[model samples]
Target: MLQRAFNKYIDNFRGFSREIWILTLITFINRAGTMVLPFLSKYLREDLDFSYNQVKWILISFGLGSIVGSWLGGKLSDKIGFYKIMIFSLMTSGIAFFGLQFVTSFEGLLVAMFFIMVVADMFRPAMFVSLGAYAKPENRTRALTLVRLAINLGFAAGPALGGLLIMTVGYKGLFWVDGATCILAILIFWIKVKEKKKSKYTDKEHPGEILTNSVFKDRPFWIFLGATLITGILFFQLFTTIPLYHKEQFNLSELQTGLLLTLNGVLIFFLEMPIVSYIERHKINKLKVITLGCLAMAISMYLLLVNQWAGILIIMMLFMTFGEMFVFPFSNSFAISRAPKGHEGRYMAIFTMSYSTAHILSAEAGMDMIRLFSYQNNWFFMGTLGIIGVLLFIWTMKLVKYEPPRNI
Candidate 1:
């Protein structure tokens, strides 16, 4: 029975095409090279000697660029194609990283950060559209989870490696390595991942047929997007406010912070795929899964209310990691499944916007909130946001129905 269960677990990873795996590999390579954003807050504060407000504004600029990039990527993916966009984003963003190494002044850093993020973020919607194009409906969630698995696995490596690199090569060296990895991922994607011509969505009409329906017209999706943005604002603190909290409240070093943050990726790397597979095979209600995930997130923040110790932080991260494992991949699959045929890029882009927008708000608002209020208050606010996220998902679930995979 144990062997059988193990085999079943292995089977979850089977059935995806070589292209899908290549796409997953591309995500992994890119994510593994993601050494910048996680450390940007710290770099701004300590290395660049910026104030709290300056750091917030710099990050906000990056967020604004992300918002633009997400929109443009989706629009351009539909018009041009995902492959071209992916290649361009990878190569140009790599160049941008190299360019960022030269910037010295605050204004220069902000401008460079904004452009780099803009180019880098263009990958999101295109990647989602390609995943939908490549995978069967029944395997969609697992496939998405597999990609996230690769991302988390890379994330597990990126920060820990980044911490080490900080001591060895400093921030500029980090950018150099990051740029090289993006270039490498681009090569793999260009050579290995082929474009597909088959219909990915349920519309029987031609690709041009559904182009008339804009994502703005999709009321249910907007409702879903709103909910996503709410959770996003709270969830993104993993990068911004949380790190600052560790620095100020706990007085932990960069290496220590990276390790603690790495705990999140470690949990996701080990558990996300199996759990998502189990939930998918068992035909569990996605709504229930999401609701539970949000509640878990809420509880994690509330747990932070009591202590500032490493033990409590780890416990809080455990709950948060579980919540992330449950929510993110399933949500991506949900967006893919709901996309209106040709409008997949737009639909997915709008969903991507939630995070991009959250990136905007989380830095500016979250930092300000922590400054004016306190870390304890921020935790309370995040907990409240999570509860609101739960209510939103419960409500949105009623408005939207999951369309099963169409065998093209």
Candidate 2:
């Protein structure tokens, strides 16, 4: 029985193109190098001696950079093609990692973080555009699931390695290793991936003409974006608030905290692809899947109220992981299904920007709540936000008439 189940899991990997596999490999390599961001809050609080407010501001800077980068990535992908934007983003951001080691002052560090995120985040929109271009319409969502599997697998490795690096050679080593990994991803991509040939469905407009297609002018998209931002605020707390909660509430060491997060990645790596495959095979409604995810996320936040209990913490992470598995990849599919021809980049960027915006709201608001009230209160607030997200998601779909775009 287990053998057949494992074979079914392997079946999901079949039928993808060479480019899709290459992109998945690139995603894995890039995500594996993502060592710095997960531990940035801890580094700021412990090593740099940042006040809660200062940490908040620094995170806001990172979010601001994400906003700029995600938008720019889309615009550039539409204008110059995904290739140039990706190569430039990867190479430049890799170099910036080395620079982060030298910045000490709060203002300087904030600026450094902003620049790193701006460069690093350019990969997202470009990557999605590439995914859309490479995968057949029917396989697009599954392809995305595969990419995310690569990401979660890499994430499962990165933090554990980061924990070891921190103990052996400090945060500076994290910077160096992460920088090298980005460069390595770039090398693999340059060698293995080629620009996809234009297909029958490809928009034939001039790149400049295509650039005129705008997401800001779409009302339904805004409703969707609003729902996305609400969910994102709660989802992003995994990176921002949860780490601090573990450190302060339980005095968990860096290794222990990294392991907690690793549990999230490990579960997703094992479960998400299979679950998505089953959903697709079973013809489940995407919106229903997403709503269930939002409710689960809200419940997870509430579970955090049972702080200092290791078993409860693990259970909370489990709920959060399952919620993310349901919410995030389907959200990508939802946006992609709605994208009009000649405007895929802009539509994707807007959706991506919702999470970027959440990073800003999540960090500043979350940290401030922890500082002013208690962490328990912060969890309650996050739970409330998640509940609001579930309502908004349901309403947003109804308001938009909920049709997938007819074209791939």
In candidate 2, how many clashes are counted?
0
RMSD of each: 3.2, 2.9
How well is each residue in 123-191 modelled by candidate 1, as lDDT tens digits?
A: 999998988888888888888899888887888778778888999989887889899899999899888
lDDT of all the models against the reference?
0.80, 0.83
| Candidate 1: residue 46 Cα off by (Å) | 4.9
TM-score of 1: 0.89
TM-score of each: 0.89, 0.89
Local accuracy of candidate 2 as per-residue lDDT tens digits, 73-164: 88777667777788899989988897788898998988888888888888899889889998888788889999988988888778878989
Q: Where does candidate 1 have its weakest 10-residue lDDT segment?
A: 399-408
Model 1 error, position 115 (Å): 2.3
Assess the local accuracy of residue 311 in candidate 1 as a C-alpha lDDT between 0 and 100: 77
